[model samples]
Target: MTPLHRVGSALAIAVALSLVTACTAPAPTPSPTPTIDDSAANTPPPTPAESVAPAGGSDPTCETIIPAATVEDFESLGWSAEQDDFRVGATIIDGGLQCVWADHAGPATDHVQIFGWAPIEQDAAYDAQDNLVGEGWVREDQPDGVYITENPETTISTDENGYGMTYLFGDGWVKVADTKQGLLLVVWGD
Candidate 1:
Protein backbone atom coordinates (compact mmCIF):
# COMPACT_ATOMS: atom_id res chain seq x y z
CA MET A 1 0.00 0.00 0.00
CA THR A 2 2.82 2.45 0.80
CA PRO A 3 4.64 1.78 -2.49
CA LEU A 4 1.42 2.24 -4.50
CA HIS A 5 0.84 5.68 -2.80
CA ARG A 6 4.36 6.85 -3.61
CA VAL A 7 3.94 5.93 -7.35
CA GLY A 8 0.62 7.78 -7.47
CA SER A 9 2.28 10.97 -6.05
CA ALA A 10 5.08 10.91 -8.63
CA LEU A 11 2.64 10.52 -11.51
CA ALA A 12 0.62 13.49 -10.23
CA ILE A 13 3.73 15.77 -10.12
CA ALA A 14 4.77 14.76 -13.67
CA VAL A 15 1.28 15.50 -15.02
CA ALA A 16 1.31 18.92 -13.37
CA LEU A 17 4.72 19.78 -14.93
CA SER A 18 3.61 18.63 -18.40
CA LEU A 19 0.46 20.75 -18.23
CA VAL A 20 2.49 23.87 -17.29
CA THR A 21 4.95 23.34 -20.16
CA ALA A 22 2.18 22.90 -22.77
CA CYS A 23 0.45 26.18 -21.76
CA THR A 24 3.66 28.33 -21.91
CA ALA A 25 4.75 29.69 -25.32
CA PRO A 26 8.33 29.86 -26.70
CA ALA A 27 10.18 33.23 -26.89
CA PRO A 28 10.04 35.12 -30.21
CA THR A 29 13.22 35.42 -32.27
CA PRO A 30 14.92 38.83 -32.75
CA SER A 31 14.91 40.56 -36.16
CA PRO A 32 18.24 40.87 -38.01
CA THR A 33 17.89 44.65 -38.78
CA PRO A 34 15.42 47.50 -38.51
CA THR A 35 13.50 48.57 -41.62
CA ILE A 36 13.01 52.33 -42.02
CA ASP A 37 12.67 55.02 -44.73
CA ASP A 38 15.66 57.36 -43.90
CA SER A 39 14.85 60.02 -46.60
CA ALA A 40 18.19 61.86 -45.84
CA ALA A 41 18.79 63.07 -49.40
CA ASN A 42 19.51 66.71 -48.33
CA THR A 43 21.85 65.80 -45.47
CA PRO A 44 25.60 66.39 -46.04
CA PRO A 45 28.07 63.53 -45.54
CA PRO A 46 29.80 63.47 -42.18
CA THR A 47 33.24 65.03 -42.35
CA PRO A 48 35.92 62.90 -40.74
CA ALA A 49 38.36 64.34 -38.18
CA GLU A 50 41.35 66.18 -39.68
CA SER A 51 43.64 63.64 -38.05
CA VAL A 52 42.58 60.98 -40.54
CA ALA A 53 44.83 61.54 -43.56
CA PRO A 54 45.09 59.80 -46.94
CA ALA A 55 47.16 56.66 -47.53
CA GLY A 56 50.78 56.73 -48.75
CA GLY A 57 51.24 60.14 -47.12
CA SER A 58 54.30 60.29 -44.86
CA ASP A 59 56.46 63.09 -43.48
CA PRO A 60 58.79 64.54 -46.14
CA THR A 61 61.77 64.20 -43.83
CA CYS A 62 61.23 60.45 -43.63
CA GLU A 63 61.61 60.08 -47.40
CA THR A 64 65.13 58.63 -47.78
CA ILE A 65 66.88 61.97 -47.24
CA ILE A 66 70.54 62.85 -46.73
CA PRO A 67 71.79 65.45 -44.25
CA ALA A 68 72.28 69.09 -45.12
CA ALA A 69 75.80 70.20 -46.03
CA THR A 70 77.99 72.45 -43.86
CA VAL A 71 81.24 74.35 -44.36
CA GLU A 72 84.87 73.08 -44.80
CA ASP A 73 83.91 69.59 -46.05
CA PHE A 74 83.44 67.39 -49.08
CA GLU A 75 80.58 64.93 -49.38
CA SER A 76 82.02 62.23 -51.61
CA LEU A 77 78.95 61.32 -53.69
CA GLY A 78 80.45 58.58 -55.89
CA TRP A 79 83.58 57.60 -53.97
CA SER A 80 85.83 55.40 -56.10
CA ALA A 81 89.57 54.87 -56.43
CA GLU A 82 89.63 54.31 -60.19
CA GLN A 83 87.32 52.95 -62.87
CA ASP A 84 88.40 53.81 -66.42
CA ASP A 85 88.66 57.26 -68.06
CA PHE A 86 85.72 57.93 -65.74
CA ARG A 87 87.46 58.03 -62.35
CA VAL A 88 85.68 59.15 -59.16
CA GLY A 89 85.38 62.58 -57.51
CA ALA A 90 84.01 64.61 -54.59
CA THR A 91 81.92 67.79 -54.61
CA ILE A 92 81.99 70.51 -51.94
CA ILE A 93 79.21 73.09 -51.60
CA ASP A 94 79.26 75.31 -48.57
CA GLY A 95 77.86 78.83 -48.34
CA GLY A 96 79.82 80.61 -51.11
CA LEU A 97 81.83 77.86 -52.76
CA GLN A 98 81.21 74.85 -55.03
CA CYS A 99 83.98 72.46 -56.10
CA VAL A 100 84.58 68.86 -57.18
CA TRP A 101 87.53 66.55 -57.93
CA ALA A 102 88.33 63.16 -59.48
CA ASP A 103 91.42 60.97 -59.84
CA HIS A 104 94.19 62.89 -61.62
CA ALA A 105 91.64 65.69 -61.35
CA GLY A 106 91.91 67.45 -58.00
CA PRO A 107 89.03 69.56 -56.71
CA ALA A 108 88.05 71.42 -59.83
CA THR A 109 85.18 73.73 -60.70
CA ASP A 110 81.71 73.04 -59.29
CA HIS A 111 80.52 69.64 -60.47
CA VAL A 112 78.01 69.68 -63.30
CA GLN A 113 75.68 67.75 -61.00
CA ILE A 114 75.74 65.39 -58.00
CA PHE A 115 72.68 63.08 -58.00
CA GLY A 116 73.19 60.83 -54.95
CA TRP A 117 73.13 61.45 -51.19
CA ALA A 118 75.51 63.99 -49.56
CA PRO A 119 75.31 65.14 -45.97
CA ILE A 120 77.37 67.91 -44.44
CA GLU A 121 79.81 67.60 -41.49
CA GLN A 122 78.90 63.92 -41.29
CA ASP A 123 80.56 63.19 -44.66
CA ALA A 124 84.32 63.64 -44.94
CA ALA A 125 86.94 64.06 -47.68
CA TYR A 126 90.64 63.44 -46.99
CA ASP A 127 93.87 64.76 -48.46
CA ALA A 128 96.64 62.39 -49.57
CA GLN A 129 97.72 62.38 -45.92
CA ASP A 130 94.21 61.26 -44.86
CA ASN A 131 93.71 64.66 -43.24
CA LEU A 132 90.25 66.19 -43.02
CA VAL A 133 89.92 68.07 -46.27
CA GLY A 134 86.26 69.17 -46.38
CA GLU A 135 83.20 68.63 -44.21
CA GLY A 136 79.82 68.61 -45.90
CA TRP A 137 78.16 72.01 -45.83
CA VAL A 138 75.98 73.99 -48.20
CA ARG A 139 77.62 77.29 -47.38
CA GLU A 140 81.37 76.64 -47.62
CA ASP A 141 84.07 79.36 -47.65
CA GLN A 142 85.44 78.40 -51.06
CA PRO A 143 85.29 81.94 -52.49
CA ASP A 144 87.46 80.92 -55.42
CA GLY A 145 84.61 78.87 -56.90
CA VAL A 146 85.04 75.29 -58.22
CA TYR A 147 88.61 74.24 -58.98
CA ILE A 148 90.24 70.93 -60.04
CA THR A 149 93.92 70.36 -59.23
CA GLU A 150 94.88 69.32 -62.73
CA ASN A 151 97.30 71.02 -65.18
CA PRO A 152 95.24 74.19 -64.59
CA GLU A 153 92.44 75.05 -62.20
CA THR A 154 89.18 74.21 -64.01
CA THR A 155 86.55 76.56 -62.65
CA ILE A 156 82.94 77.63 -63.28
CA SER A 157 81.25 80.63 -61.78
CA THR A 158 77.74 82.09 -61.66
CA ASP A 159 79.08 84.77 -63.92
CA GLU A 160 79.50 82.12 -66.59
CA ASN A 161 76.42 81.71 -68.81
CA GLY A 162 74.96 78.27 -69.65
CA TYR A 163 76.56 76.75 -66.57
CA GLY A 164 73.31 75.23 -65.44
CA MET A 165 71.92 74.36 -68.88
CA THR A 166 74.47 72.02 -70.42
CA TYR A 167 75.67 69.24 -68.13
CA LEU A 168 79.47 69.00 -68.05
CA PHE A 169 78.48 65.31 -67.88
CA GLY A 170 75.39 63.09 -67.35
CA ASP A 171 71.81 63.68 -68.59
CA GLY A 172 70.39 66.71 -66.76
CA TRP A 173 70.68 70.40 -67.42
CA VAL A 174 73.95 71.52 -65.84
CA LYS A 175 72.69 73.42 -62.81
CA VAL A 176 74.14 74.17 -59.39
CA ALA A 177 72.35 74.57 -56.08
CA ASP A 178 72.28 78.16 -54.94
CA THR A 179 74.88 78.18 -52.13
CA LYS A 180 73.91 74.69 -51.11
CA GLN A 181 74.19 71.10 -52.44
CA GLY A 182 74.72 70.42 -56.12
CA LEU A 183 72.04 70.72 -58.85
CA LEU A 184 70.88 67.10 -58.35
CA LEU A 185 69.46 68.03 -54.94
CA VAL A 186 67.83 71.37 -55.76
CA VAL A 187 65.94 70.10 -58.82
CA TRP A 188 63.64 67.09 -59.06
CA GLY A 189 62.23 64.96 -61.89
CA ASP A 190 60.62 66.08 -65.18
Candidate 2:
Protein backbone atom coordinates (compact mmCIF):
# COMPACT_ATOMS: atom_id res chain seq x y z
CA MET A 1 0.00 0.00 0.00
CA THR A 2 1.01 3.65 -0.49
CA PRO A 3 2.34 5.63 2.58
CA LEU A 4 -0.98 7.60 2.80
CA HIS A 5 -3.07 4.41 2.52
CA ARG A 6 -0.92 2.79 5.27
CA VAL A 7 -1.51 5.77 7.65
CA GLY A 8 -5.24 5.77 6.95
CA SER A 9 -5.53 2.03 7.55
CA ALA A 10 -3.55 2.31 10.82
CA LEU A 11 -5.81 5.16 12.11
CA ALA A 12 -9.01 3.19 11.25
CA ILE A 13 -7.72 0.05 13.08
CA ALA A 14 -6.78 2.12 16.22
CA VAL A 15 -10.23 3.76 16.40
CA ALA A 16 -11.99 0.36 16.02
CA LEU A 17 -9.85 -1.16 18.82
CA SER A 18 -10.62 1.80 21.16
CA LEU A 19 -14.37 1.50 20.52
CA VAL A 20 -14.41 -2.22 21.21
CA THR A 21 -12.38 -1.79 24.48
CA ALA A 22 -14.73 0.92 25.74
CA CYS A 23 -17.87 -1.15 24.99
CA THR A 24 -16.48 -4.30 26.64
CA ALA A 25 -14.79 -2.72 29.73
CA PRO A 26 -16.40 -3.45 33.15
CA ALA A 27 -18.03 -0.54 35.06
CA PRO A 28 -16.46 0.72 38.30
CA THR A 29 -18.06 -0.54 41.57
CA PRO A 30 -19.83 2.04 43.80
CA SER A 31 -18.82 2.70 47.40
CA PRO A 32 -21.20 1.78 50.20
CA THR A 33 -23.32 4.51 51.86
CA PRO A 34 -22.64 5.35 55.48
CA THR A 35 -25.32 4.46 58.03
CA ILE A 36 -26.71 6.99 60.50
CA ASP A 37 -27.19 5.75 64.03
CA ASP A 38 -30.15 7.16 66.06
CA SER A 39 -30.39 4.88 69.05
CA ALA A 40 -30.54 7.73 71.61
CA ALA A 41 -33.34 9.50 69.76
CA ASN A 42 -35.84 6.81 70.75
CA THR A 43 -35.33 7.36 74.47
CA PRO A 44 -38.05 9.25 76.40
CA PRO A 45 -37.33 12.71 77.76
CA PRO A 46 -36.94 13.36 81.47
CA THR A 47 -40.06 14.23 83.46
CA PRO A 48 -40.73 17.90 84.15
CA ALA A 49 -40.70 19.33 87.67
CA GLU A 50 -44.05 19.30 89.49
CA SER A 51 -45.46 22.41 91.13
CA VAL A 52 -44.68 22.47 94.84
CA ALA A 53 -46.79 24.15 97.50
CA PRO A 54 -45.39 26.75 99.84
CA ALA A 55 -43.70 25.20 102.84
CA GLY A 56 -45.95 25.00 105.91
CA GLY A 57 -46.81 22.79 108.88
CA SER A 58 -44.63 21.07 111.48
CA ASP A 59 -41.36 19.64 110.21
CA PRO A 60 -40.82 16.42 112.12
CA THR A 61 -37.46 14.74 112.48
CA CYS A 62 -36.70 11.85 110.14
CA GLU A 63 -35.75 9.68 113.06
CA THR A 64 -39.12 10.22 114.73
CA ILE A 65 -41.14 9.24 111.68
CA ILE A 66 -38.93 6.31 110.58
CA PRO A 67 -38.55 3.53 113.13
CA ALA A 68 -35.05 2.93 114.54
CA ALA A 69 -34.84 -0.50 112.97
CA THR A 70 -35.90 0.82 109.56
CA VAL A 71 -33.47 3.69 109.87
CA GLU A 72 -30.71 1.21 110.70
CA ASP A 73 -31.63 -0.88 107.71
CA PHE A 74 -31.48 2.15 105.47
CA GLU A 75 -28.16 3.12 107.02
CA SER A 76 -26.83 -0.31 106.42
CA LEU A 77 -27.75 0.07 102.78
CA GLY A 78 -25.82 3.36 102.58
CA TRP A 79 -28.93 5.51 102.53
CA SER A 80 -29.49 8.68 104.59
CA ALA A 81 -32.63 10.20 106.03
CA GLU A 82 -33.92 13.67 105.17
CA GLN A 83 -36.72 15.62 106.87
CA ASP A 84 -38.55 18.69 105.71
CA ASP A 85 -41.87 20.52 105.88
CA PHE A 86 -44.82 18.37 104.86
CA ARG A 87 -46.38 19.18 101.51
CA VAL A 88 -47.99 17.16 98.68
CA GLY A 89 -48.38 18.60 95.24
CA ALA A 90 -49.87 22.06 95.86
CA THR A 91 -51.36 21.28 99.28
CA ILE A 92 -49.65 21.77 102.61
CA ILE A 93 -50.12 19.46 105.56
CA ASP A 94 -50.36 21.64 108.65
CA GLY A 95 -49.05 19.16 111.23
CA GLY A 96 -47.31 16.27 109.58
CA LEU A 97 -43.99 14.51 109.19
CA GLN A 98 -42.02 14.24 105.96
CA CYS A 99 -39.29 11.66 105.96
CA VAL A 100 -37.02 10.45 103.14
CA TRP A 101 -34.45 7.70 102.89
CA ALA A 102 -32.01 7.54 100.01
CA ASP A 103 -28.41 7.51 98.96
CA HIS A 104 -27.41 11.15 98.70
CA ALA A 105 -24.64 10.29 96.27
CA GLY A 106 -26.93 8.40 93.91
CA PRO A 107 -29.45 9.71 91.44
CA ALA A 108 -32.67 11.36 92.67
CA THR A 109 -34.69 8.31 91.64
CA ASP A 110 -33.17 6.27 94.45
CA HIS A 111 -35.34 7.41 97.33
CA VAL A 112 -38.33 6.53 99.50
CA GLN A 113 -40.51 9.32 100.89
CA ILE A 114 -43.04 9.09 103.72
CA PHE A 115 -45.58 11.49 105.22
CA GLY A 116 -47.82 10.70 108.16
CA TRP A 117 -50.48 12.56 110.17
CA ALA A 118 -53.26 11.50 112.56
CA PRO A 119 -56.70 12.81 113.36
CA ILE A 120 -57.47 13.81 109.79
CA GLU A 121 -61.19 14.30 109.44
CA GLN A 122 -63.11 12.16 106.97
CA ASP A 123 -64.51 15.14 105.06
CA ALA A 124 -61.10 16.79 104.69
CA ALA A 125 -59.51 13.54 103.56
CA TYR A 126 -62.23 13.06 100.97
CA ASP A 127 -61.77 16.62 99.82
CA ALA A 128 -58.05 16.01 99.39
CA GLN A 129 -58.80 12.88 97.41
CA ASP A 130 -61.19 14.80 95.20
CA ASN A 131 -58.57 17.44 94.53
CA LEU A 132 -56.03 14.77 93.64
CA VAL A 133 -58.50 13.06 91.29
CA GLY A 134 -59.08 16.38 89.61
CA GLU A 135 -55.35 16.54 89.03
CA GLY A 136 -55.36 13.13 87.22
CA TRP A 137 -54.79 10.81 90.17
CA VAL A 138 -56.70 7.51 90.27
CA ARG A 139 -58.63 6.63 93.39
CA GLU A 140 -59.54 3.14 94.64
CA ASP A 141 -61.44 2.42 97.83
CA GLN A 142 -60.09 -0.31 100.09
CA PRO A 143 -61.91 -2.10 102.89
CA ASP A 144 -60.12 -0.16 105.63
CA GLY A 145 -59.38 3.11 103.81
CA VAL A 146 -59.01 4.86 100.47
CA TYR A 147 -55.98 4.55 98.17
CA ILE A 148 -55.07 7.32 95.74
CA THR A 149 -52.13 7.11 93.37
CA GLU A 150 -50.76 8.81 90.30
CA ASN A 151 -50.33 5.37 88.78
CA PRO A 152 -52.46 2.74 90.51
CA GLU A 153 -50.04 -0.03 89.46
CA THR A 154 -47.00 1.71 90.89
CA THR A 155 -46.52 0.84 94.55
CA ILE A 156 -43.95 1.99 97.08
CA SER A 157 -41.31 -0.71 97.02
CA THR A 158 -37.81 -0.57 98.42
CA ASP A 159 -36.50 -3.02 95.85
CA GLU A 160 -37.80 -1.16 92.81
CA ASN A 161 -37.40 2.28 91.30
CA GLY A 162 -40.84 3.79 90.83
CA TYR A 163 -42.44 7.09 89.97
CA GLY A 164 -45.81 8.46 91.16
CA MET A 165 -47.76 9.08 94.37
CA THR A 166 -49.26 6.43 96.67
CA TYR A 167 -51.53 7.76 99.40
CA LEU A 168 -53.41 5.76 102.01
CA PHE A 169 -56.24 7.42 103.89
CA GLY A 170 -57.74 5.96 107.06
CA ASP A 171 -60.60 7.13 109.27
CA GLY A 172 -58.44 9.68 111.08
CA TRP A 173 -55.04 9.44 109.39
CA VAL A 174 -53.35 10.02 106.07
CA LYS A 175 -50.08 8.55 104.88
CA VAL A 176 -48.37 9.44 101.63
CA ALA A 177 -45.37 7.90 99.90
CA ASP A 178 -43.45 8.82 96.74
CA THR A 179 -40.72 6.40 95.79
CA LYS A 180 -38.94 8.34 93.06
CA GLN A 181 -39.26 11.84 94.48
CA GLY A 182 -38.62 12.43 98.17
CA LEU A 183 -41.69 14.39 99.22
CA LEU A 184 -45.06 13.68 100.84
CA LEU A 185 -47.88 15.45 102.70
CA VAL A 186 -50.26 14.37 105.41
CA VAL A 187 -53.51 16.19 106.19
CA TRP A 188 -54.34 16.29 109.90
CA GLY A 189 -57.22 17.61 112.03
CA ASP A 190 -60.28 19.39 110.71
Candidate 3:
Protein backbone atom coordinates (compact mmCIF):
# COMPACT_ATOMS: atom_id res chain seq x y z
CA MET A 1 0.00 0.00 0.00
CA THR A 2 1.05 3.65 -0.44
CA PRO A 3 2.16 5.77 2.61
CA LEU A 4 -1.27 7.60 2.69
CA HIS A 5 -3.19 4.31 2.68
CA ARG A 6 -0.97 3.00 5.45
CA VAL A 7 -1.75 6.11 7.63
CA GLY A 8 -5.52 5.73 6.95
CA SER A 9 -5.43 2.06 7.94
CA ALA A 10 -3.55 2.92 11.15
CA LEU A 11 -6.15 5.59 12.04
CA ALA A 12 -9.05 3.19 11.33
CA ILE A 13 -7.37 0.48 13.44
CA ALA A 14 -6.88 2.94 16.35
CA VAL A 15 -10.62 3.94 16.27
CA ALA A 16 -11.75 0.32 16.12
CA LEU A 17 -9.46 -0.59 19.03
CA SER A 18 -10.91 2.25 21.16
CA LEU A 19 -14.50 1.15 20.39
CA VAL A 20 -13.72 -2.46 21.26
CA THR A 21 -11.99 -1.44 24.53
CA ALA A 22 -15.01 0.64 25.63
CA CYS A 23 -17.58 -2.04 24.71
CA THR A 24 -15.76 -4.84 26.61
CA ALA A 25 -14.76 -2.85 29.73
CA PRO A 26 -15.84 -4.46 33.04
CA ALA A 27 -18.61 -2.83 35.10
CA PRO A 28 -17.73 -0.97 38.29
CA THR A 29 -18.32 -2.75 41.61
CA PRO A 30 -20.47 -1.17 44.35
CA SER A 31 -18.70 0.35 47.34
CA PRO A 32 -18.85 -1.63 50.63
CA THR A 33 -20.91 -0.31 53.55
CA PRO A 34 -18.96 1.88 55.97
CA THR A 35 -18.35 0.36 59.42
CA ILE A 36 -19.94 2.21 62.38
CA ASP A 37 -17.66 3.49 65.15
CA ASP A 38 -18.22 1.90 68.60
CA SER A 39 -18.29 5.21 70.50
CA ALA A 40 -21.07 6.64 68.35
CA ALA A 41 -23.07 3.41 68.45
CA ASN A 42 -22.95 3.16 72.26
CA THR A 43 -23.54 6.83 73.07
CA PRO A 44 -26.81 7.58 74.87
CA PRO A 45 -29.16 10.24 73.62
CA PRO A 46 -28.96 13.65 75.31
CA THR A 47 -31.94 14.72 77.44
CA PRO A 48 -33.69 18.02 76.78
CA ALA A 49 -34.11 20.87 79.26
CA GLU A 50 -37.51 19.41 80.25
CA SER A 51 -39.85 16.62 79.28
CA VAL A 52 -43.37 15.49 80.25
CA ALA A 53 -45.13 12.11 80.01
CA PRO A 54 -48.91 11.87 79.68
CA ALA A 55 -51.32 9.38 81.31
CA GLY A 56 -52.92 6.49 79.49
CA GLY A 57 -53.92 2.79 79.74
CA SER A 58 -55.71 1.49 82.90
CA ASP A 59 -58.04 3.46 85.16
CA PRO A 60 -56.13 5.36 87.87
CA THR A 61 -57.63 5.68 91.31
CA CYS A 62 -56.58 6.86 94.81
CA GLU A 63 -57.42 3.70 96.76
CA THR A 64 -55.14 1.70 94.48
CA ILE A 65 -52.23 4.03 95.17
CA ILE A 66 -52.69 5.54 98.65
CA PRO A 67 -54.49 3.32 101.11
CA ALA A 68 -55.72 6.28 103.16
CA ALA A 69 -56.07 10.00 102.39
CA THR A 70 -53.89 10.98 105.36
CA VAL A 71 -50.52 12.68 104.95
CA GLU A 72 -48.80 9.30 105.28
CA ASP A 73 -50.46 8.13 102.10
CA PHE A 74 -48.40 10.63 100.11
CA GLU A 75 -45.08 9.32 101.38
CA SER A 76 -45.54 5.92 99.77
CA LEU A 77 -44.70 7.56 96.43
CA GLY A 78 -41.08 8.30 97.49
CA TRP A 79 -41.33 11.72 95.86
CA SER A 80 -38.97 13.42 98.37
CA ALA A 81 -36.10 11.20 97.23
CA GLU A 82 -33.64 12.82 94.87
CA GLN A 83 -32.93 11.54 91.38
CA ASP A 84 -33.50 12.27 87.70
CA ASP A 85 -36.91 12.88 86.07
CA PHE A 86 -37.66 9.17 86.31
CA ARG A 87 -37.52 8.65 90.08
CA VAL A 88 -40.17 6.29 91.56
CA GLY A 89 -42.87 8.95 91.96
CA ALA A 90 -41.42 11.88 90.02
CA THR A 91 -43.78 11.16 87.12
CA ILE A 92 -45.21 8.05 88.82
CA ILE A 93 -45.60 5.80 85.77
CA ASP A 94 -45.68 2.00 85.77
CA GLY A 95 -46.49 -0.33 82.89
CA GLY A 96 -46.93 -3.49 84.95
CA LEU A 97 -49.87 -1.99 86.85
CA GLN A 98 -51.27 -0.84 83.49
CA CYS A 99 -49.85 2.70 83.63
CA VAL A 100 -48.06 4.39 80.72
CA TRP A 101 -46.63 7.83 79.98
CA ALA A 102 -46.44 9.99 76.85
CA ASP A 103 -43.30 12.13 76.77
CA HIS A 104 -44.87 14.80 74.54
CA ALA A 105 -48.26 15.38 76.19
CA GLY A 106 -48.98 18.50 74.12
CA PRO A 107 -48.10 22.20 73.96
CA ALA A 108 -47.00 23.81 77.22
CA THR A 109 -50.48 25.32 77.52
CA ASP A 110 -52.46 22.10 77.15
CA HIS A 111 -52.02 19.42 79.86
CA VAL A 112 -52.61 16.47 77.56
CA GLN A 113 -51.00 13.31 78.96
CA ILE A 114 -50.70 9.53 78.73
CA PHE A 115 -52.25 8.13 81.95
CA GLY A 116 -52.46 4.42 82.76
CA TRP A 117 -52.27 2.04 85.68
CA ALA A 118 -48.86 2.37 87.33
CA PRO A 119 -47.49 -1.10 88.02
CA ILE A 120 -46.03 -2.18 91.33
CA GLU A 121 -42.47 -3.39 91.02
CA GLN A 122 -42.34 -7.17 91.35
CA ASP A 123 -40.39 -8.61 94.25
CA ALA A 124 -40.02 -12.27 95.03
CA ALA A 125 -39.82 -11.54 98.76
CA TYR A 126 -42.94 -9.42 99.00
CA ASP A 127 -45.13 -12.16 97.59
CA ALA A 128 -48.40 -10.77 98.97
CA GLN A 129 -47.30 -7.17 99.18
CA ASP A 130 -49.19 -3.98 98.33
CA ASN A 131 -52.11 -5.57 96.58
CA LEU A 132 -54.35 -3.30 98.67
CA VAL A 133 -52.63 -0.08 97.50
CA GLY A 134 -51.92 1.08 93.96
CA GLU A 135 -50.47 3.94 91.91
CA GLY A 136 -50.92 7.65 92.65
CA TRP A 137 -52.88 8.71 89.63
CA VAL A 138 -54.92 11.75 88.61
CA ARG A 139 -58.49 11.09 87.71
CA GLU A 140 -61.20 13.79 87.47
CA ASP A 141 -62.65 13.19 90.92
CA GLN A 142 -62.11 12.21 94.54
CA PRO A 143 -60.10 8.99 94.12
CA ASP A 144 -62.04 6.96 96.72
CA GLY A 145 -60.16 8.76 99.51
CA VAL A 146 -58.85 12.16 100.56
CA TYR A 147 -56.14 13.86 98.53
CA ILE A 148 -52.66 13.77 99.98
CA THR A 149 -51.13 17.17 100.71
CA GLU A 150 -47.85 16.43 99.02
CA ASN A 151 -46.44 16.75 95.52
CA PRO A 152 -45.86 20.38 94.53
CA GLU A 153 -47.70 19.57 91.32
CA THR A 154 -50.85 18.78 93.31
CA THR A 155 -53.33 21.63 93.14
CA ILE A 156 -56.49 22.50 95.10
CA SER A 157 -59.61 23.55 93.28
CA THR A 158 -61.57 26.81 93.77
CA ASP A 159 -64.54 28.80 92.49
CA GLU A 160 -64.66 32.49 91.42
CA ASN A 161 -64.52 33.53 95.06
CA GLY A 162 -61.39 31.41 95.36
CA TYR A 163 -63.29 29.13 97.71
CA GLY A 164 -62.79 25.38 97.57
CA MET A 165 -65.16 23.42 95.39
CA THR A 166 -66.35 19.86 95.71
CA TYR A 167 -64.42 17.26 93.62
CA LEU A 168 -66.65 14.55 92.22
CA PHE A 169 -64.10 11.77 91.85
CA GLY A 170 -64.36 10.39 88.31
CA ASP A 171 -64.84 13.72 86.53
CA GLY A 172 -62.10 12.61 84.08
CA TRP A 173 -59.47 15.21 85.08
CA VAL A 174 -60.45 17.08 88.22
CA LYS A 175 -59.32 20.14 90.19
CA VAL A 176 -55.91 21.44 89.17
CA ALA A 177 -55.94 24.33 91.63
CA ASP A 178 -54.23 27.59 90.69
CA THR A 179 -55.70 30.19 93.10
CA LYS A 180 -55.25 30.16 96.86
CA GLN A 181 -58.22 28.61 98.63
CA GLY A 182 -58.52 30.96 101.61
CA LEU A 183 -54.86 30.55 102.54
CA LEU A 184 -54.82 26.75 101.94
CA LEU A 185 -57.36 26.08 104.73
CA VAL A 186 -60.00 25.10 102.20
CA VAL A 187 -57.72 23.24 99.88
CA TRP A 188 -59.10 19.65 99.59
CA GLY A 189 -62.10 20.66 101.68
CA ASP A 190 -65.58 20.21 100.28
Q: Which candidate's TM-score is highest?
A: 2
**TM-scores vs. true structure, each candidate:** 0.18, 0.51, 0.20
Candidate 1 wrong stretches, greater than 4 Å: 1-114, 120-152, 156-190
**Which sequence of candidate numbers ranks them by TM-score, best first?**
2, 3, 1
Candidate 3 root-mean-square deviation in Å: 22.4
User: Each candidate: what lDDT?
Assistant: 0.28, 0.56, 0.28
Q: Order the candidates by lDDT, highest first — what do you get?
A: 2, 3, 1
- Candidate 3 residue 13 Cα shift, in angstroms, is 0.8
lDDT accuracy of residue 142 in candidate 2: 68
* Maximum-lDDT candidate: 2
Task: lDDT winner between 1 and 2, please give it.
Answer: 2
Quickly count the clashes in candidate 3: 22
lDDT of 1 at 68: 31
Candidate 2, residues 1-190, lDDT tens digits: the string is 9999999999999999999999999999896432212222233322322212224754345654433444566676677766665555567766665666667766566344454443466787878889988877778786747777775454435213344566777766666666322222232321
